[model samples]
Target: MNLEWLKGIYVPILTPMKEDESVDFEKLRKQVNFIIDGGVHGILAHGSNSEFYMFEDDDYEEIFKVILEEVAGRVPVIMGIGAIRTSKCVKLAKLAERLGADAVAILQPMFLKPTDEELYYHFKTIADSVKELPTLLYNNPRIGYTLSSDLVERLARDVRNIVGIKDSSGDINQLLEFIRKTRDLKFKAFGGKDTLLYSSLNIGAVGGVCTTANIFPELVTSIYNTYVDGDLKESLELQFELNPVRMSMDKASFPVATKDMANINGMDVGKPIKPNHASPSGVVESMRKEMAKAGLLKG
Candidate 1:
């Protein structure tokens, strides 16, 4: 498969929910248009930032359909499968293929730290199950174990459809090693952390699946656009401006800041799903001030 279309800023968009904690498809469609209009290059439905764990299989189908429909072929869509069971992951991967997604990103099985052999098989099984949809390995250490470069290389070499990885290890070196190790293969590397977008691209990542793009798509996409356009200084500067705000997410709870930023920006993405409430008012205000400092917020 020509994976050339895989390069650029991809948004792991927020799943806009209703006050009752159910997915509001209307808001989801609006969010899709919101990010695409903001200049993102691709869309990743069911990403970590999307609260994917809360939904059922039926939920996945509708979510995928809605996103693909809203996207309308404007940008490539990659459906993400982060389920823990190999069977479940395969089911979602097949679902993505059935829905006409351009690609599928499978997150390492969460909550269970499988051995290297088991891990390899887990990814291989899912990729093999799909006929031809490009599979991108998603390694988020927050799941408790990282996908070592060696493991990733082995999968890339052995699995015909495993074409890339989204390294959210937060360690730039880890991201670099994946790129370095896979350089000879058809594999593509994307930084999963928003703060490392410029550095990741500088070190040979094709692009990033940035959570911030859901809030500030133009800002995030500009980093990739400038870097690809040969403006290293501007791209680095843009990354610098994005880092503090992205880092400030730590002040709020996990994954809440992205939604907080969206709400404050007047996107009204609604509250995060239950058990994950809105960020404190002070936290949101502080985040707002940070965006203002970065010139992202005006009056």
Candidate 2:
């Protein structure tokens, strides 16, 4: 497959849920259009922000189907198959391929610290299971371990289908190393942190798998489009403007703030899944004020 089209802003879309925490297909479809129209180059259906671990295989297919249907070839879609078990990961990757996903992203297995060799087998097996869909390694250290650049290089060399990696380690040097090491291969490195989008591109990363794009895609896309358009000054200015809002998310619970911002902006994305309750009213109020100040919400 041609990996050239993979270069640009991609949103690890938030799964819209209802009061009971079930997938809201209606809202989900609308969101697919919301971001596409907002100028994102592509969409990630079951990304980390989508809460992939919370659903079953059948639920995964349903969510993937709705997103694919709504997207309808407007932009490439990558389905995230993030699971602790290799079997579940392969199963979801196959499901994504059957549903016509443009690619699959395997998030680092959580709760288990596998050795380098074991990690290689885990990712390679998933990539080998598919026929031709491009595969991306999601190196998120939040899972307790990181994919060393050496391991990433080995995968890129040995696996024909492993096309790229999303380095969410929040370490630019590590991301730079991945790019530097894989510079010759047909590999792409994407910045996984919202704060480092511009810098990532500056250092030769293809794009970013930014969570903030779930709320303000245009803001994030501008950073990519502007940079690509040869306006580094404007791109850096946009990135600076986005930093505060992205940083503020740390104040609220993980992932809740994305949904909260969507709802605050009247997207009505619904509450996060149960046990991961909505942000406190004060937190929500504070986020609202922050967004308004950022020009995301007009008071």
Candidate 3:
């Protein structure tokens, strides 16, 4: 209910899987501690980086339960219940509410996706389903769907619970427009791409929903803290330092590359859920040098 905590680095925490690709709750616990101990503002469980689509039945609930229990109100936890099925997404949103998540972030249905009007109704239905839980519309164009600023403005204006959106597009103009359109509505806008964190802040974005923070929480949080403290020089320096890792991981298979960076940093994040999802050996090797260059290595 308290949205103020949204204004910092909220990690889209990875769902660590065992060798058979079953969810590794133990390692997941360690990851929660790593980020919490590392001092991130919040956690976003089951995000794309968390491999939400790879999940089977009950997989979503169990993983989310682990995260909710581990986080234990230490900070906010935003449950991601994105699905290609509209009804299924609503069910997951309700589940998040029942489980006491502070909020839920929804991904617009991907394949056979929706028209803009359908998208509006889809989000509206979910928001109406759980009026008490604040919803953040996720706009990641990489997925081949985007939540335009106009659509977001409409959601912010029409849905009381639809209080914000996360714009993954690295385009500053889109982010600025989202900011401008929702400025008077008290709606929150978050930068979804790690590379745009600093610029997002300068454009009046409250914070970042970043993938890189999964490994380097301190770096992401430092950017937010420094910028908020009026230290533009240090903030820009930190944001600049994070770019290589962001770009490097992006070249690989999402959270796989991200998880590999965690291992490079000495955290045992295990491998990604799918074997083919693994980053190429060369990519992993290159990530090591890049992670080190970004000063994200453990110890």
Candidate 2 has its poorest 10 consecutive residues by lDDT at 290-299
Write down the lDDT that model 3 would get.
Answer: 0.86
Candidates 1 and 3 compared by lDDT, better number: 1
Residue-level lDDT tens digits of model 2 in 131-157: 598999999888888999999999999
Residue 125 displacement (Å), model 1? 0.5
Off by over 4 Å in 3: none
- The residue-by-residue lDDT of candidate 3 on 1-299, one tens digit each, is 56777778899998777877788899999899989887798999988888888888588889989888988889899998678777888898899999998889988778766678889999999989999999999888877867778888999999999988888888899989999998998789899989999999999999999888888888889999999999999999998998987788767765578777777777767787764466778988888888777666667
Model 1 weakest lDDT span, ten residues long = 290-299
Q: Give the TM-score of candidate 1.
A: 0.98
Q: Estimate each model's TM-score.
A: 0.98, 0.97, 0.96
Q: Clash pairs of candidate 1?
A: none
Q: In model 1, state the lDDT of residue 117.
A: 94
lDDT of 1: 0.90
